[model samples]
Target: MGRGLGALIPDFDEDKAQVSELQYLAIEKIVPNPSQPRVIFDEEKMKELADSIKCNGINQPILVRKIDNAKYEIVAGERRWRACLMLKMEIIPAIVRELTDEESLQIALIENIQREDIGPIEEARAYQQLIKRFSYTQDELAQKIGKSRPAITNAIRLLDLPDEIIEHVISGTISAGHARTLLSLSVNEDRINALHKIINDKLSVRQAEDLVRRSMEIGKVPTPAKQAYVFEKESYIKENIWKKFTFKGNQKTGKFVFSYSSPEEKQELLNSLGIQ
Candidate 1:
């Protein structure tokens, strides 16, 4: 399909439903619905379910909408759809359900989220969809999902990430911890750069966080090297000749002076170095 979700799955099936209730079942047929929004199925879990289906022979059917003679849209159980596909079964058991676009999306969101398995990017997309398509407020979404406003806010923030970083995070090139650390960076470009560095350098989450903190601290300095250069020059005299001379300087090197004490110190220096 050369599209976003298509990269995850070459194709998807929507022909059947995993037998719910009468309200759930509307029809029974197999159609490959490629437009389904939910992608990124967990492979390990799919294998487990595939084993179960092999033993019990698909105990439950899935709910889907008829797209046409040979295609159908999934209303729920995308995971089941993926598992069945992996099982390589010719047909899946399903009941058809006719739902409005909004209803189907809501169901999809609830289904994926309830599993606690949706990726941050997909979850953020679903949240944005709810907001843009259905005019859902953050508070409303929070209330609907039994979460706090800050939780909702943070979840939505995932959408602000650059597409490349998001793809990296989704593809497991970087961890979620690293992704969150990158998100903490205020600038989008810097965040993206850090993301690339994290992957390239294989930096840990803590390392990424420390790098961000250092970057912020460096950002705060005023004429940083200007102040540092003066300090270094003045400290060099004291560091190299502390036993022989004392030195001091003001904000610039022009004020530096090397000092010696009375004859007693001068004689002590000569004695120490055997320079008598």
Candidate 2:
């Protein structure tokens, strides 16, 4: 199923361990999944989570599988595990399950994508790893991850951007939208200048897009243009925001609505943006 870890994990109450598999395993015995998709965890968010766990304790048990008589590997709940470690928690509630390497990777990937604000570059690298390790076709992987094929294509496309641009995407200095807009320019110098403008000037996606478009029309980076209009509230226009949504129109103008066929898919997008 495309439902991520939720598909593999059984539903249970947060107040208590309702599943019989729940056990309080020593934290020292657990090791991180080698194929874990997330590299960077938000420091502020991690502290926030630690505070929550400190006050309330873990609401859900982590998932792990025995690697040897004395060792275990995390199947999911790495963030929870990490948080408990921060608290110097000696043992964590966990559910032991026997899963293959591919299953472990798949669960971790979906869990992060659906539940965390994983960066586009990290996300793309995760997809790349899954494809390279498992020899999965884009379509198959799309279905497995509960994302559209075009969505996968768009995410992976960000990997081809300059490493500097990729670093910006990972660091949240600039957005994947800005990087993708830079992809429109074939010249490295122009792309780098546009990236600097994005960081220094703090440009929006539409502004960046317009900037790139102008640079493409001219040979070099042109002068910044005046605003067409300013709005009172944020989210000035829906059409111009640089999300990885599918666009329908072409060359000059296009329209796309944030449509989702399932609640899970919709919620995943919202979680990625840190929206409630």
The model with the greatest TM-score is 2
What are the TM-scores, per candidate, against the unseen true structure? 0.62, 0.71
**Error of model 1, residue 106, in angstroms:** 2.1
RMSD of 1: 25.2
Worst 10 residues of 2 by lDDT: 226-235
lDDT of 2 by residue, 160-224 (tens): 88766775676577878888899888877778778877766889999999988888777787533
- The ten-residue window of minimal lDDT in model 1 covers 1-10
Regions more than 4 Å wrong, model 1: 1-28, 32-35, 66-72, 88-91, 220-276
129-191, model 1: which lDDT tens digit per residue?
767776779987776666688877887787777766766666566776777777777877677
